[model samples]
Target: MIKNILKSALNNFQAFLVTWVVIIIVNQLFIFGACFAPYCLLAALPHTFVIAVLLNYFLNAEESNKQLNSSKIDSNSDFKYTQADNHIEDNEFEETEIPFCPKCGSKMALRTAKNGAHAGNKFWGCSKYPKCKGLLNI
Candidate 1:
């Protein structure tokens, strides 16, 4: 039913959002704030299908990494690695996230900007706050 489909889509929103981000980035190659290229329209169909397939990928990010025998994620350790039996190893390669800080290249934490021209706006701030003052708007 339509209701069931909507509910399923809502549950997989992370993948949907990621797919949209990719589409927007690709569309940017043609123009900013607009997409008039025929390739963009053609690519939309496959992107939607890929988004649905990536539902589990986006929702269980750490699990997916384990499946690939990649770096183990430690959410409790602020996504940083520590020497332990069941923790991430330093030698393992790290995946580069698109939203990492532009200044210090650290993963930006989602935070509210207190004082700025766009006060109260949600944005990404470098995890290394006092040490690195990198920020990005949502």
Candidate 2:
């Protein structure tokens, strides 16, 4: 527990030091517009603390997301594929055999409708999708 706390503290300190230097440089360059501005230190201190805290929060959130994903994969080590995962395999087709879009002449792609009257149904859709809006029943 102590070791983990120390490691976290060390990471935070390193992040704070980097943020402080960057904030000082930015404040000197933009706000004070001088090579060395002692007065900019006042503004940089608070800005550095805020930026460091935000950076720490976002980094921790990303680490947690990775851990969550790894844990989920580990729990499913037997490798059972869900319906969503197997959808592409179940609806396999030759890309060369699909029809061209009537509206744009672009090659049509096989797509599954998620809503409307064709919900859960497969159809040939324009590769451009929203822009072309051409579709054909499979």
Q: Please give the CA lDDT of all the candidate structures.
A: 0.64, 0.73
lDDT of 2 by residue, 1-138 (tens): 445433443566776567657767776788777657565677567766666556555665566568779999999899977666444663486655879999999999989999999899999999997999998987
Tens-digit lDDT track of model 1 for 15-134: 666765665566555544455467665655565555554553455556444744643334344655557678667779666455888998888888886796978988888999989999
Pairs with backbone N, CA or C atoms under 3 Å apart (clashes), candidate 1: none
